[model samples]
Target: MTSLTPNTVAADAEGLTLIISGDGIGASSMLQWRGVDYPIDWIVDVDGDGGSLGSAIPASALAIDGTFETVLVTVSTGGAASNPLPVTIFGPGVGAAESAVAGAGGTVTASTGRLTATYTRAAGGYGTLTAVDYAFPTDPLLPPNPISPVAFVDLQLLDGVAGDTLVGTFLPPNPILPPNPVLPPNPVLPPSPIRLAYWTGTTWAPVSGSGAVAPTFSFDWATSSASSATVTFDMTSTPQITALGGTVIAFVSAFAFEGFSAPADSDINVAKAGRAVPLGWRILDLGGNPILNLSSSSVDVSSVRIVCESLSGEAEPLDAYAPGSSGLQNLGDGYYQWNWATEKSWAGTCRLVRFDFGDRNPDGSPIYRTAAFQFTR
Candidate 1:
């Protein structure tokens, strides 16, 4: 017995065609078409009907007796019958004319009395199809159901820091349905749910909050409207911000069905309390480890610099220290020491010193002042 691949059936005014395929069928193989045990016709491989895989059997030849919604078609070889496949038979006047049907996320095409639909399933493979019979103006035109995808229009950073709230505005897609004419028309649609995550120097971290609320970000749709929405990321609730080095915060907005949008960063610098204190006369990495300076022959010095300013009285500028500068010397293991003696005026007074090492985080944000050291000589 040969196994057959199921055939797709398409019907028209002329007749029906069973597009069939199978394995292990030779010239002597017998092919039979049947509907409910009523023998329709039999074709031998040597006959022209059975020579090709797709054999077209006319409706008249099948002798379809009466009205039937579905016809079961099967193939048989060596007296062994394959499983029957059902073909949907449209009623007389239905689907007669070329119809254009549009459904959620997809479209349908009907041409020359054949109906075919190209549809994309929504998330989780679920979708709805709405079909209507086309019979001139008598049939009311389907109300316009526009589907607008959710999107962020204006993203700005109102504030960014460990303690302050990160704020921004986004626009959700417009509603598709029409307003109710009887009851009070609700013009503004509710904002879709969203999650806020900021780019840590290393990876994306969710903006989590402390207190009774687990996640700290707040969806402030009340402050928004149909044209736009607002959200706040509470940095104080997220303890991870304390370890972050820079004031620049890059964050992203995400929707369950829409996925993530490109990252929108805060341009304004947010003040971070208790930034790492720079080591007096020393340079350190972001992790608070002293960065030792190696010998000039072994180290590339172009990227390193130190800025010192007197915090007491009027701010006095001290000559910036660099690798080749007389007072700047490299220790070992990425550590460096600045000799205050070179700047005689800067040695005796209280001063604020900042280190600028050519180091960057994985997210491309510059590793700003590892520590701000206040030195009193």
Candidate 2:
């Protein structure tokens, strides 16, 4: 004897259906997820119940709420039957209706935002199918789970419809500020006692260095004569010097004396001899090799200071070669002497002196001098 089994089954967002191909003699039954019997009425042309199938088993018998559920078809027949299989029923968030229609089965299920309809059949011939519609949830609600201020709000109703759109607006974070302001200028070097450039609002003009001073456009001279004249000129920010219109010349001349070398005085005889001349003098000639002169012409020694060294390596306090003490007072005029009597030395050692000059060329460059000698007993 042949058994009765479900040969076809179908489901949509609205409801589920099962078709059992009947054989010679057998009965078909519907099962639910709980393995319990679910009421089902046979579809027929004539009325069996009070009036129709609706009267025998209410539509609620096959209808599922907005919750996950499943149903199956079971057949009891001649020889043997397969195990009862279950087909899950998902909540119709997008399309749901009160009752099944003649064409679609039951009320349509509703859709949330961007949701697709999925229908499945199990233990039956029909396969699972999926359908998408632009229609989605209309009322947007915050995501079931959220993190920060930003969240995905699902729009209901409209989610299942085609060509539907979801739109929303939110404020962003604030802007950032700009950087700090700039500072002004402050002067350090003295304005005078030093040759300076002209003030040009922003910076000093006629800045001089590297072998030359700033440029001069004109020489405004208030001179008595070419030989003994004082020439004045305007030095611009540039270097090349020129006369305004006419040609003018001011000659600078000096006198010199050439002679033999000066005798080196004994360091011990400094007291009795009263003064001892320097190793070299400011002279035109000394033993043929020019003397280590001090002037704007050659050895331009500006300020001289004396430090005495002893044989024991101890040193004395530094003494300036001022006007009355040493002959260095007339730096440019004549020769001078450094005597041990006036500029005393420490007990065990002789004198070791070092000289320094301000701006080797009277134009700001460093110059240095050093000498050593032994005082007799």
Candidate 3:
């Protein structure tokens, strides 16, 4: 091969073509990655001699959590392998101090967490993009929904030219470790229901919608309701961000069944002294799969527990219900429910009652989805 065009790309990038401008081009020519030969997508030859050949990389083949990684690109034909050309595949999560995309000026960084994101600056991108701090620029650092956030990322940039765009795909790091942070994590595909919010000088809010919520940017969510999200940060309104070089922080929280549910995440429930209230939700893994235990009629009960706390954070365990009981049990397909019987002594008192689901993470960590509420009787 003589030359390769557009050899560099960010991790998890898609729909990109790699061009090879070399000699000995033939119909039998093919592209190879990781010793596996894939069919050439297309080719352009001149006078049947030497012309540019084209091949594409497999999906998610270049996805990585660390940067400065290199891959060798080669074209093979007639049982002979051409010389390997080094292609730089820049990754994310190389530490905040050293995290920068392979490009002219812009930089990107992410915090050390499972839920993370990687950014790609558009061709019209400009300016000095600095660090990615997980914070809100204004008061009420979080949104009103879900009560808390799984992770947050702030994209800091300045002097950005108009019409500059950025495509950021957010998912768990390592693609699958400590819980299998795999790209497009299984059972959870694109259109993942990931809750991404921006601090709108007051509270964390969603992108634009039909509710007259003024758009912060063009939200092109490629995935949702699962474990990943992709959005394009259109910098057409760069002025709104560059309030004297202030950073525009974007916060994201996944709506996986792993966190907050029962009284529906920070909600309040009214109960009678002798009434039974059902606390139930569909339990899901980080990847959005139902935690099924077909061996038993009920859902796995070993990981379920309940606790009650006072309004001032005084806590104590309450064994009102447990699995294999008369009224509390797993309903199957990862759904757990309990008809909580409110005792007469629990009436007229404000208490924070929480149900801790003992679902585990891929790394064997004691991960649990909790449902807490102000139980007022």
**lDDT value for candidate 3?**
0.44
Backbone clash numbers for all candidates listed: 12, 37, 17
Cα shift from native, residue 146, model 1 (Å): 26
RMSD of 3: 16.8
Tell me the alpha-carbon RMSD of every candidate: 26.4, 40.3, 16.8
TM-score of 3: 0.35
lDDT of 2 by residue, 1-377 (tens): 12122221223333334433333322333333234444434545432333211113223444544232334434433434334433334343322211100112212222222222222122223221221111123112111211011111111121111111111111111110011124211011111111222222333223232233321211111211111111122233122122111111111011122311134322321221123334333432211222234433222333233343433332223222222333343334345343223233433334444443221212123334444444322
Question: Which stretches of model 3 miss by more than 4 angstroms?
Answer: 1-95, 98-126, 133-148, 169-171, 175-195, 207-230, 235-251, 256-274, 278-310, 313-339, 342-352, 356-377
Ranked candidates (lDDT, high to low): 3, 1, 2
**Candidate 1: residue 98 lDDT (0-100):** 24
In the range 265-366, model 3's lDDT, one tens digit per residue, is: 333444444455556666553334575532233222332223434333323323233333244455787675665555556655544344433322323243
Off by over 4 Å in 1: 1-12, 30-32, 36-51, 61-68, 92-377
Candidate 2 overall Cα lDDT vs. reference? 0.26
Q: 1-377 in candidate 1: lDDT tens per residue?
A: 22232222233436654445566444444445554332223334634555445445666543332221234455656667664443433333232222221223432332221112222322232222211122211112222211121221111111123343322233222232222345332221112223333334444344444331322223333332233333333444442322322211222222111111111011111111222111223333222334343233332222122343422233222223232323445555444444322233333333223333322222323333322222233
